[model samples]
Target: MKKYNCIWVLLCCLACVGTTSCSDKKSSADEQEKGVTTVLPDTKNEVTTQILKKRTFAHELVSNGKVNARSKADLRFETGEVIARIYVKNGDRVHKGQKLAELDKFRLEQKLSQAEDALLKA
Candidate 1:
């Protein structure tokens, strides 16, 4: 039984090696053929040719009015409580609806207990 397991493992290993070798050989042959046809553009005279003539490099420096979000928010908490987390810092870009910050959940737990107690009393 041990001999049979050894044979099976060896055969599996050989099969994997055979497949990888065959694929490597095939890809290498393809790449060799592709390399022969891959022509690199001549860059030797490009810079010299451009410098032999006068050229005007014009760039637009436009002072445009504000292009901004349709609406903006200065997010603030209505009640002052210790913040548990701040996921974003100033100058960090965020997608809409991303969790930017979180209030201390321990603070909310007290409010939850109070509400539950009031419900039980009623």
Candidate 2:
């Protein structure tokens, strides 16, 4: 009875697999008979031609993002003073000990003169 049950299960599995494969083949044959077609563009007639010339081309990229420096230095004056002149703009390359901007010379001179007068009185 156990052997008979195993044989029945095996036959059922074989029938399922055979039916699935036959259904797939039938659907594929029907699709082929429908004859789906695709139209390709005519390459010869639609071809674009350009004369090659030796010229310099500049590529510019516009983007919206924050750029960070590899090494950054926070610049500040030791004393609070108005800026007299600026020698460089933003994103300009700078070297070590380069003078980026100058303090107001006239105001600095006045401070020095006042300090000298106070020292003399003391």
Candidate 3:
């Protein structure tokens, strides 16, 4: 234990002494360099011209699309009637202009039925 303590004290003394000596040498060098540092500000004060140019680039692409059957139903509406005929339920396959809903046209079909019945009776 006594040996370890002697080594620790020796290291601390050596570190402090080395650092103090280095700082003294650096301070003397800094004093000598101060004369040259003063001239740097005067040299920087003179303006020097530098040229810069702007550049631009444009890019484009070609595309094509089909032009056919341009008809469209912006707003589709049903008459003020109940859904009498629904050939398809929810989640059913559909194509263009497929019959999806029918109003309460029972009376209209019945009228045709009556006309056919009269023709049979005759």
Candidate 4:
């Protein structure tokens, strides 16, 4: 019984080795016939080339919403001053140095007077 078991184990090992060698040989022969060479890919320094061909892609953007500006800005005053008046409304075209809103100067004038009195005392 031990002799039969050893024979079966040897046959299984031989069968696996034989199949692996035969497959390797056949694959190498097939690659040679197709002029294919095995090359290790350099994933770190891989260079890819692409042809710049013009492709027309038609995409219909169907919606009830309007396409607004690509960029939007929320303008505000740097100081925490009260806004007395606003010259421009929403979606208004404004230029640089344009007055957008007026600051409430009554409180600002009182603060300035206090600061000046402190400076005079010092």
What are the models' TM-scores?
A: 0.39, 0.42, 0.25, 0.43
Q: Report the C-alpha lDDT of model 4 over 16-102, residue by residue, as the tens digit.
A: 999977774676677777986689976787699999888998989977977687678877777898899999987788899999889
TM-score leader: 4
lDDT of 1 at 24: 47
Candidate 2 residue spans exceeding 4 A from truth? 1-67
Give residue 24's error in model 3 in angstroms: 28
Query: lDDT per prediction?
Result: 0.84, 0.90, 0.74, 0.87
What is residue 25's positional error in candidate 3, in angstroms?
Answer: 31
Candidate 1 per-residue lDDT over residues 5-109, each given as its tens digit: 999999999999999777746776888887686678777654433346677979889796966665667999877888889999866779988999988888789
Better of 3 and 4 by lDDT: 4
Sort by TM-score, best first.
4, 2, 1, 3
User: Considering only N, C-alpha and C atoms within 3 Å, which residue pairs clash in candidate 2?
Assistant: none
Q: Give me the runs in candidate 4 sitting further than 4 Å from their true place.
A: 1-67
- lDDT per residue for candidate 2 within 17-99, as digits (tens), equals 99987774677788887897788987766678999999998989998999887887788999999998999998899988888
What's the CA RMSD for each of the models? 25.8, 8.5, 16.0, 18.6
Task: Write the candidate numbers in order of decreasing lDDT.
Answer: 2, 4, 1, 3
